[model samples]
Target: MLAKRIQPMVSQARRLYVELMFQVMGRALQAVSEVDDAVKKETQALPAGFLFEMMVMPNGPRLIVEHTGLGRLHYHGASAPRPVDLSIQFKHIAHAFLVLSFQEKTAVAFANDRMLVDGDISYAVRMTRVLNRLESFILPKLIAERAVKEYPSNLHLPHKLISAVRIYLKVATNFVETVRA
Candidate 1:
């Protein structure tokens, strides 16, 4: 009886957590892409006006990132249209959080059947590479090493520091603009 009573609460908490994860990731991706030219370049080959999303299954939180131009990325809000060109969906909230928290590398999670990709495989691979690049810029070296398959040899400490600073500044500025608008 106690287990049954607790299950619903646990489910609700998990749902909330997944939603929060989407919000946080959306903002961070926006910041990183805004500040990093190389990261933007990764999206240049993608189709313009294409939308990509990362979501949790069964009505959990979802985040959408759109390729607005040749090399431009934008965070599309929940209130926006639902015309997703590609989506990566976690099978469960725990699986979603594990990757979001950098507790598990995304490729490992995907290989373990923790996620589902609802789009072209080639495009998904390109997006995965972009995510890895953003992770390198935003996460600490130690955490990023564990999160990515292999840290880039050329990403020296000074570059990481500069990128981090730029990301933070851009995020803050965007936040302020969002509030004003």
Candidate 2:
């Protein structure tokens, strides 16, 4: 009886998720292509359109940026919303690439596993060079400020002390790890 009650809703949610993904992928491709074109102009050695792939794991994402020609660079993953492109894990990765800071060393360490690399190094190097060129100037920022916005004026009192304790424990664990390192 419970299964019958939930099945239709689950199907509807799945359909909605797919529709939204297509929308996001479409927009991301446009942004990537535009950035690539502009970067190529400033850097002479930049790839035209690359077909690089990435093997991103929980620890980090490995980039394999490739060039299809003199005009574009491709990262490995699902075909982006463009002509020459990199493939993203599609389900999990595209969002991470958009959000995570590249400053962390652990992320770079995960990328060093050669077995994860299934494609061209020249392409990855070329795309990396293009990204370096783009890095010179600040790219347009996409912030999720509103998503995490807190209404300080409308704050709610905690319903349970246990929940607060849990938060503290998590923070303590993180602190200890940092101190030990």
Candidate 3:
């Protein structure tokens, strides 16, 4: 049980998203003023309409990072009113939660599908490109750090990798399609 809860920390998708969001945000903010300024400025256009609910599935907490035309980055539970522009789901957000401290590697995480955007690819991609530029150079140290930080929990061989097979067998106990495929 404990392992399951903590397992997402090593998820490829979650880790990737965490790295990517930071990277993209940092990239878009370049030349705007400083990193924070760019995060604030570029996100200002995020539409005063909807909330992005990024849910890390199967009991992992939801990380809701929403922006609006109103001029600020708001986390979940903010009293601010809204019907937001896009509330894309990012399953297993905890993977992306840690170690987005840098500008460039953050972008890489997103590109890797650790952060899957669902609403509007155009806006998401545009944001991604902007963030990519701010990353002066993708350093090996950063990559190494991410790998070290994410590696221990990747229980890829059995549970995760073979989940499909096990679940199929369980569900298909009486079906022929289970073996046919």
Candidate 4:
């Protein structure tokens, strides 16, 4: 009886956690594209109006991002008006939770068949790079090291610290504006 009662609560908690992570990640991506030269360059390489989405399968939380040209990215909350150019779907919410919680590296998850990609492989590659870069900015060095395939050796502590602060500030501002809207 206790197990049955706890299961639903655990599932709900995981779902909420994953949903929140996706929202923050979307904001972080938007902020990083604006603030990081390397991220901007990566976004610039994507076609104008390109849209990328990541979600858990079967009615799970999702995030969509668009390359709006001029080296900019826009987060479109849980849905977008335009069709997605690239979509990555996790097989299960638990799989998504593992990745979003930084318990499993994306590359490792891919290799383990925890997710599926439904678009151009090259574009997915580019998006992965952008995500890795964004993760480095928002996550602590130790956690980022585990989350990304490779932590950037060139990113020193001071620079990473400053960039993290800026990225976090932007994310917070975006959330506040979203609440207001």
The lDDT leader among the candidates is: 4
**Top-TM-score structure, candidate number:** 4
What tens digits encode model 4's per-residue C-alpha lDDT throughout 1-181? 9999999999999999999999999999999988899988878988999999999998899999999997799999999887899999999999999999999999999999999999999889889999999888778889999999999999888888888899999999999999999
Q: Which sections of candidate 3 miss by over 4 Å?
A: 1-35, 78-84, 88-104, 126-181
**Against the true structure, candidate 1 has what lDDT?**
0.82
Candidates in order, TM-scores: namely 0.87, 0.32, 0.39, 0.98
lDDT string, candidate 3, 1-181, tens digits: 9989877765766556654454333222322212234345555666654455444444343434455344444444312254434443444555446434443254455655656676776667544433332232222334534433232233333533343244234333423432475
Model 3 scores a C-alpha lDDT of 0.43
Off by over 4 Å in 2: 1-38, 41-50, 55-99, 105-107, 110-115, 139-181
For 53-167, candidate 2 gives per-residue lDDT tens digits of 4433443333344444545433233333444343333233433333333322222423533223334545445434443333222222122222112212222234123323343
Candidate 2, position 1, lDDT? 100
Query: What's the true lDDT of residue 58 in model 2?
Result: 44
Q: Candidate 4: how many backbone clashes?
A: 0
Looking at model 4, which ten-residue stretch has the lowest summed lDDT?
Answer: 133-142
- Candidate 3 TM-score to native: 0.39
lDDT, each prediction: 0.82, 0.38, 0.43, 0.93
Residue 161 of candidate 2: its Cα lDDT?
Answer: 31
RMSD, one per candidate, in order: 2.3, 17.7, 18.5, 0.8
Once model 2 is optimally superposed onto the true structure by TM-score, how far is the C-alpha of residue 119 displaced, in angstroms? 1.2
